[model samples]
Target: MKILRKERGGHMLDSKLIRNNPESVKKGLKVRQGDSSLVDKFLAVDEEWRKVTIEVEELQAKRNKVSDEIAEMKKNKQDASRIITQMKEVSARIKELTDKQKESETAAQKIALEMPNLPHLSVPEGMDSRDNREVRTHGKKPSFKFQPKAHDELGRNLGILNFEQAAKISGARFVVYHGLGAQLERALINFMLDLHTKEHGYQEVMTPVLVNAKSMTGTGQLPKFEEDLFATRDDNFYLIPTAEVSVTNLHADEILEGEKLPVKYACYSPCFRREAGSYGKDVKGIIRQHQFNKVELVKFVQPDKSYDELEKLTKDAESVLQKLGLAYRVVELSTGDLGFSSAKTYDIEVWFPSENQYREISSCSNFESFQARRAGIRFRSNPKAKPEFIHTLNGSGLAVGRTFAAILENFQLEDGSVEIPKVLQPYLGGQKKLEA
Candidate 1:
């Protein structure tokens, strides 16, 4: 198991990066000083196996010819024992070659799968998340005249959040929104969907929350992050962690017209994640829940316009927070912090006064044809031109559950009340405040 060092650039590379650069994969293995000869060994084994198979085939052909001679001899009342013995040896040799072929193929596939993707030119060299850069900060952090309350406390007092009831229904790390909280969550969903579809020119869509194993692997979720997903035993389907899986795969194995090069879509769905590695982080609130609602934005664009589309996509996500008057900052994730399929990722972190730090509310990323290649989503430049993979980008307009939590934490007054943001007033039934 060779661990490749993270490379320096502005963006992370797609998983297929190794397929595009075979030498880099070997160099990566060499860097770890892990049996760099395995690649050549596999190739040699494969070549030898092929040669042995051909030899076996030639022997079998001779055996068949001799067998025919024996049959003709038997017909003529002559000896056939020597021909039968030769047939047995040829069969044994064939079996040996067949077994060797299987071994070589298995060994080759094992080595192939272990190869890592090449680091993108834009990905900055870093060992871990600590090296990530803070790109920019948006709205000023609100200064509370008094001590601020955490979202959990504020939500419980206001009779909007019911963790105990949620625990009874599901298990721990789940939340039950009641009355205004429920309404507010729904409003956020509608607001985001409408904004993206009506203002941002995205097509609204609804997708399944449970997807098959192939769908998971197509997005680089399986084979690597399987434990972080909830799988159904009977059908082998896993609950989706984000709408990205479903929306981006809508055109899987299909080719679209060049005119539709940039296909923008917004979807509202309930996302599920096992959060297998997060044992004690954000355990008390909706920030790290087993399930949550989010309005997701996905786009398929021409490779040339992908980076520009990423900026527009990021702003599309930002508009939600801007409308809600949420104080948030945009951070450029370092290579180590980038997700499995993203080349570049921008995380929108909203201020949480109680925690006295910013927390991630949404992540917008440009996959640069990574998912498109896996999913076989392509677009033809002309009616007769060859199809090429389209760049895929997705982001959460906002995670409704986290947005709800942020609102409670950031807008809570000293008197144990939560003020509704002006933009959400209409959706909140004109209610100005949430109180116990």
Candidate 2:
């Protein structure tokens, strides 16, 4: 891997950004170092291509000269057959070189696009999510007088969640929400979206669930994470894993004004994840599933304000759990455990009393310009000034499915009824309790 020299400019294009830019990718090979060998290989291939091109061009020039000579010879009543044979040979050689050059260029492009982005300076280096760091805790964990029941047991006993029937209809990892369970999930979505839009000042948006490959890659979900997606063969569109993909890509290829520095958006959508590698984890409940509802918040801001914005964003997500009276904690993901696109991340984990442990329910990340560069989201300080990539940040206001699960497990009484939180009662049509 060549470590490309860091060029001094108002904008700093990282490896992912350069890979997405054809011209930058070609130029990056000449400077960067981590992947210098790959760059050298690509350069060697390019040099060979240039040599072949020059050779082909020279051969064509010679063939043209020979044709003119052959014409003169014919006009002078002399033999011209030898020149014609040589021209045919030159044309064949040119075709071969052209084909080889085309193959080399295609191979280079594939390799370039497949490379992952480098970890940001602030990101902690780790291999997986388990290596994440615990940042802080919020609200106290509930202590039950009686033995607590898992969400699945409580939900089944209360006649609210039906996993068996859902499997019968849609296969495994799916659940049917009934009675208050269904209403609770719906209320959470509406509640989160309303809070972000009305109080948080985020614009409410609804984006397409199906998007192109570029949209996925722009959000750091492609090339390496392709296995975690569900794709359609027709036009190659994938079902979005979260509304983040659509909302973040809203300004894809567009430049905005600096006055709009902190552009905020809130969205609610059904997310789909293949969960390809997780065969048994969280298989008992909606914690890890194929389809789940989520309310997402995304923002675009000046680079200098990103970290501050990250804290606010995490608080914004925490507010939802707080309002619901759910016991949860904030964990700062370590360098080794952060997602590919995130420079830094904070995971909000809600307590599940039955499991006697906190489980992740929301993830908020400050990607800086990682997603913006790929999505071509930029901003200009002045009308005539050049545009630069804006920093991108996103967090789950709350995962509706998990919120529903947490409420069921944590609020269940000895009698098997679940009490609705005061804040959610209005959205639940004033229902005070979920009784079987």
Candidate 3:
């Protein structure tokens, strides 16, 4: 069996890959608009660490040989103090080299952790959301006779959403769903969870919303995007930005049976984010709230089946909108717009009538082995086969709050009442509409 090397706090890319093909790694980073110089820094530190490691090994070998000679001299009752004194100097030099080796190794690993995952070859080459390619659009946008109202305005008029009260309690980017609004949010969560588990072959899991720092680092949320997360004062725990953080980390530092190659999980959790650097954008409603609800879909699969699994995962997300008869489109994210941990991604953007455009409701991504390597999640084909990192994929089966907002906007009537989607009506005790 081959020994699989593990690193502290995990790593995004294989160190051997970066060391042997530095140019290829740099090229990949350039495609993602990342700093290619990081690869150079890691290589330099790695080389220094390797040199120091060799020096330490050589010194240890010399020390061992001299120790044997000194023992033999003592057995024969001859003086061995001179060689013993030299060995002390050699031991001190070995300690110095060993410390240097550990430092360089740590520096190299830190650089590796900072580097983003390379974009997939299939990802479109361009910058930002404008460069994204639209794959398909679904459902027809609802036509309203009167001017369609924004979700916030509609909710406020119906007395179901209270942003002012929420603001007083928790500051901006928060909402208090009252009466039917609260029920609607709860209904959406149950609806999404049921649809995924019963129809999409996903096992439902309720994971912790508060995770440790190691859990965050395992899922690629640490060391780079820490500012975007809401952490406790001591920084030992963080409120989950999405269930993906807690759910994906479930198999961390563990190996699974290969026969269970595609492990799928659907988790519903309250997500929290600081929404850093977006103070001016989408501040009007729950569209970009600091806290929201989501049903996240996560998968662990064989590498060969990951892309196919990505497509399936995306459709599972789209199914939510389709079932609700919501208008949406699937857009392939460009390399520059790809996420830090994703190799390829497709965003499910739902039409918002008031905005007169589409807003992303979910992002379905295939991380290849990038996250798996970092989380130490692996699988073996057979007991005799070597373990390999499994590919990881996740998406919002549907962001519950966004789905709630979409319904409010798309189903709003001229009379200020909101019609419930036929599919969700059962969840609300056969109620067909929400009126003031």
Candidate 4:
């Protein structure tokens, strides 16, 4: 049995297409604003690797024939010294070819992993987020009667957040939640989990906060994106960059019945990232954090229904902001701004009154079998049918820290207090407002 397929965590891209029709793959990458030169390099290395495989097979065939000759010679009580030497020489040649094959395979694998998923046909062409097309806006942007303070300033005035203390203990991009700040964070988590499980037909999951390298790779966060993750000091495991890493890998290497076609999960986990590339961007306040809380939505479904499912997932995330009385807009990501594994994406940005512009709080994406192909997650349509890779999708139900910041800035009262959204009042035990 061919138990191991190089497809599993070797790299998410389709090796066959890359090796046979690299030009098409190059065009797709270019559409996604990715450097297509990797395809050229991968094709060259893969060709050499295949050549080595052929040479190794020929040597093995010669060795096998010689082995039979040596056995027959022994049976005939004839000389075997010359044949034995030939066998040894063939063996040495095979070893050398095998080593060369390994080197070429490594080079190809690196390029494959770096290649991003192809953009869906419907995606708009663009160069970056600047060119993203806004689909629709929900809720009206709150117009303040008086000058409004930013979330961080309001948080400090309310005595519910301490940035200096957080920096002292951890470093920049960290915040110490004080009193109501801690309670508010907790309340938001419970509220989101309840809404997803009760109303959205999703099962709640508490996934691990840390995961192995393959788990990261399954969700398209490894090899190319390793520098953006935080690793444990004593282990190879990385801090879960997002709950999607743990939740999506839940069915890795598993084959499910067709009845389980649409498996949905709502997971909560602490997300950690090194934020490696953003040197001076969003450096102030809790807008960007080294550590944050997120409620994630993950789905594994039949291939044909994936786009439809993506629409619903995006709505599910939007519901969070609606329930909190926040204004938001959904923007469809163009090819250039799409994530590594996503064939299509929609980013939901919440309105921050102080900033007078919407800020992203959720990103819903449909990976269209890219992740399942890497994770080896498949489903059989029936007993007589072969298993096929299922489509994988995930999104932030809402990033809690960003949401928390939104509430502070949007719900700020003239008296320097923050009112809790009505949906979360029950979770907060009838607490309606937070004050000093």
Candidate 5:
């Protein structure tokens, strides 16, 4: 008898974990404010599939035994037609059961793919962003003698940003950076790339801005967030919302040696998004642009050292702001505030002087094995060892446009001029400030 091979669509959550520790999965879903009933639904389908599989196996075993008996009857030159007919009936039954088994497995795996990753133990439980805990703050908030102007106004006054021209060219939620504004944006991108590659131990990479649907799903962006994405007309390709999508999937369906446990990449790309649900929020500035530039940091590491690597990744991002002398704080995202694929997250909010508050400039996240599992990224501990899912992590080393805005707002002089940060001065040919 030949055993039927099980087919799978792609890598997903640990099926064994879901089957054995169902209650644990339920608790995790509950903590994330997700419906725990999904676990029950998955369990029901999974159990049904298991039962069908067992029945198919039993039928196949019976057919194998009957075939052996028929072979013996033929060798003795006896009548074997009745038993041969019985074997044909058993073969038909096995085929029917096999079809049912495939259907049930597909249904079970569908539910499994829809489920989100479980939050890490260190991730605090909460209902929303308000419950997030502040980890630390860096640098002093710049004190202005007079009321400061917003970055949009400052950019317009200096003749470095043209919103009107941008609207005429590309509709709203887009901007045209003129002269020094464009220079500052370019400088920030280079500064971040250099810092991450030269100092932070990451290899710089350039990736495609347009990716296929599978690439999107690999990074946990599709299947649930299709509305928020910008797709091409004829193809199933999507314009990436962040460099994370492209960089993190660089090692998709790959297996690495144990000696190269932690592989890191820093990529610079122009990101696109539909911003579907964020109406009337930061609509006046490049903060919520339809297209913007960012330097993304991605890491694929062994599971045991992922969290430790997370801290270092965060610090690497923070170092960008520190070098620019921007005041910012790090906040640990609670369960509900955490991203869909992230087990834990830290949002680095930069201080905005005009708003008298902070806004997110970067989000450092540890996806653990959630993304790795989905993308089929694995690593073996030794030559003879079994391959296991590698942990994936990514963060905006710094959103370049936001950094440009922060520099404009935080370093604006009372004389309507914006002082260039010392670190960025060399990149701009030592220009000290931008003035009208």
Candidate 6:
């Protein structure tokens, strides 16, 4: 129950549907970037599994009848030796059938968990981020009077950022933030937490940075993407890649009453990722790091209201940039580009002056019931009502390091100084700028 078993809706694909009309599963599989013929392979194995289950059921019933007869003969002082031997034979057959049924079911479940969540009907059809449709753009992209320095150079000149020391100690994709640089990252964390908790009605939480394997699986990050995780040998604990993994699993194996259909949490954690798949990408900057701070937003809501909740979630994340006067754009992810557990997603990209383009700062997604099904998160409409999977949603209100980098590149002045946004001035003790 802590992880996922006894597959139900949301986490479990409709195996019954596939058995009845494999064409249905085949059609839906393509929407998830799956092989269309996978259904055929699944059905072939499941068909044998069904047969074994039925055989086990029939043998078990026969053994029950024989046991009843033996009891009656014993009471009557009659010989029951022959009946006892027959019962043993029936028991053996039942055990064999049971094992066969289990093997088939285990394989089917493995395949099912590997499949990605189905795309929402409204999502555009295409492959990767390149095909993501632009939904909206916000604020104004700043134009520098002189060519703007990249964030790394800007921070280096100001004596606040050091990749050399970071690499000497921790290897690549790590950084050491000093003085104002460290303060800026801290300020962004507090600013985001306060905004989300006070104005956006989120309950702030500080979740653990290391979690058990089951917790990782509950949020759909295991068995499929294990390579991306950093695990400890002592107890199979993993360094959390995001607060979303810890926060979302808070209600795992829980049942909420109808009145509490919507629950929101704003969590802060220093995320860790191996960057396993990115060999040469963002190799020199904080964009892809071994560890970074982030303020995460997570929600649980009724299935019917999940999409509406997604729009609100996206805007809530955008508000962070808005307050800081950072320009950005939002793009709706296509089916092929969707995350493993998300049905629909919106990527918020902040404009970086040095790069001359926007880069993703947050990805807000509505997982429908996909994660709930996996995590055993459910709610009952009433005391007498049946429990149903609740919808899950999450987003990065903003990544702290990315925000820090954006500020440095966007606000760099010609005099080797960086201007601080007015909203963050109070957080930085009314400091005006970081000067060399």
Predicted structure with the largest lDDT when compared to the true one: 3
Query: Which residue runs of candidate 3 sit more than 4 Å off their true CA positions?
Result: 1-9, 61-86
For candidate 2, lDDT tens digit of each residue in 1-436? Answer: 0111111111123533443454544433322213434544545555665676677678778878888898899999998887788778888987887677666555554444444344555554454666666778888788889998888888898888999999999998899999778888888889998899999999999999999988897887876689999898878899999999999989987899999779999999999999998998888977888999999999999988999999999999999999889989898776556666776889999999998999989999988887787677889977888988889999999888999999988888998888998999999999999888
Q: On residues 1-436, what C-alpha lDDT tens digit does candidate 5 reach at each position? A: 1212222434356777878998998899889887778788888978888898899889888888888888998899999998888788889988898888888777776676677889999999999999999999999999999999999999999999999999999989999999988998999999999999999899999999999988888888877889999999998789999988998888888888878878999999999999999999889878899999999999999899999999999999999999999999999999998888889999999999999999999999999888887777889989889998899999999999999999999999999999999999999999999999
lDDT of 1 by residue, 1-436 (tens): 0111111110112333443544665554443333445456545654664676677668778878887898899999988887788778878887777677566555544443333333355656565567667888889788999999889888998898999999999998899999998999998898899889999999999999899876776676766678899889888789999989998889887899988668999999999999898899889877899999999999999999998998899999999999998899988877666776777888999999999998888899888866776667789978898988788899999899989988888888889999999988898889999988
Estimated TM-score per prediction?
A: 0.81, 0.80, 0.94, 0.93, 0.92, 0.93
Q: How many residue pairs of model 3 clash at the backbone?
A: 0
lDDT of each: 0.79, 0.80, 0.92, 0.89, 0.89, 0.87
Worst 10 residues of 4 by lDDT: 1-10
Query: Whole-model lDDT for model 1 versus the true structure?
Result: 0.79
RMSD of each: 7.0, 7.2, 2.7, 2.4, 3.0, 2.4
lDDT tens digits by residue: candidate 6, 143-186: 87898888999999999999999999999999999998999999
Rate residue 346 of model 5 by lDDT: 97
The per-candidate count of clashes, in order, stands at: 8, 19, 0, 0, 0, 0
| Candidate 3 TM-score, C-alpha based | 0.94
Clashes of 6: 0
lDDT of model 2, residue 381: 75
Instruction: Give one digit per residue, the lDDT tens place, for model 4 in 354-407.
Output: 888999999999999788877888899886799988899999998999999999
Tell me which of candidates 2 and 6 scores higher on TM-score.
6
* lDDT at position 253, candidate 3: 86
Quantify how close model 4 is to the true structure by its C-alpha RMSD in Å: 2.4
Off by over 4 Å in 4: 1-4, 7-9, 61-85
